[model samples]
Target: MKISTTAQAGALESNDVLVTVMPNDQGGVQIQLETKRVIFKQFGKQIEEVVRGKVSEMDVDDVIIKVQDKGALNYTIRARVQTALERALASGTRD
Candidate 1:
């Protein structure tokens, strides 16, 4: 799916993650992650893996994903990313 505009899901609350999806005309998946320094040091790779895995599973070739995590679990992160991707796909022109 192609992301035609910016869309987001989830929030900044504890145990939640905010996922934002945007069109990436340059191609390929790009991710911008935000979290506490400590959390990044500990779970940064895992969080990124979750995002990339989900995007790949959904068959999206190009997108810009921004993740703001507030100690969310992997499932929460995946769900938020999926929701945001769905929204972006729905709003985009058909491929």
Candidate 2:
């Protein structure tokens, strides 16, 4: 799925994560992740892998993704990214 506009999901609350998806003019998936842990360098890779997998499964290409993790699990991150992508796709169709 192609992202036609910017969309986001989830919250900053503990055990939750916020995911944002936006159109990328340069093409390809770009991911930015923020977390409070000092081990973000490691967790960031894990988070990126999860988002990349989901976007690939959804057949999405050329978009920017931003993730804010508040102690959320891998599954939660995946769900939030999926939700954001879906919302982006839905909004695109409505436009």
Candidate 3:
């Protein structure tokens, strides 16, 4: 699935992640993640892996994902990204 426009999902609440999805002018998916947790250095790679996996599973490509992580668990990240993608696709369809 290709992202047709900019979209977002999730909240800034604790233990949650806010995800923003946008169409990329270039090729392939680009993920930008931000986290303030002390364990970020250790868990950053895992977090990125989860996001990439989720996007690929949705068959999405050539998009930019911006994530603001608030110490969320892996499941939370997955859910947020999924929800964001769905919202983006749905909105794109409407337009």
| TM-scores, one per candidate | 0.94, 0.94, 0.94
lDDT of each candidate versus the true structure: 0.93, 0.90, 0.91
Least accurate stretch of 10 residues (summed lDDT) in model 2?
36-45
Residue 70 of model 2 has an lDDT of: 89
Q: Over 4 Å off in model 3, which ranges?
A: none
The Cα error of candidate 2 at residue 70, in Å, is 0.7
- Tens-digit per-residue lDDT, 8-68, candidate 3: 8888999889999999989899999999766578888899999999999999999999999
On lDDT, the stronger of 1 and 3 is 1
Model 2: CA > 4 A from native: none
Report the number of the highest-lDDT candidate. 1
What is the alpha-carbon RMSD of candidate 2 to the true structure? Answer: 1.1
Superposed on all Cα atoms, model 3 deviates from the true structure by an RMSD in Å of 1.1
Our tally of clashes for model 3 stands at: 1
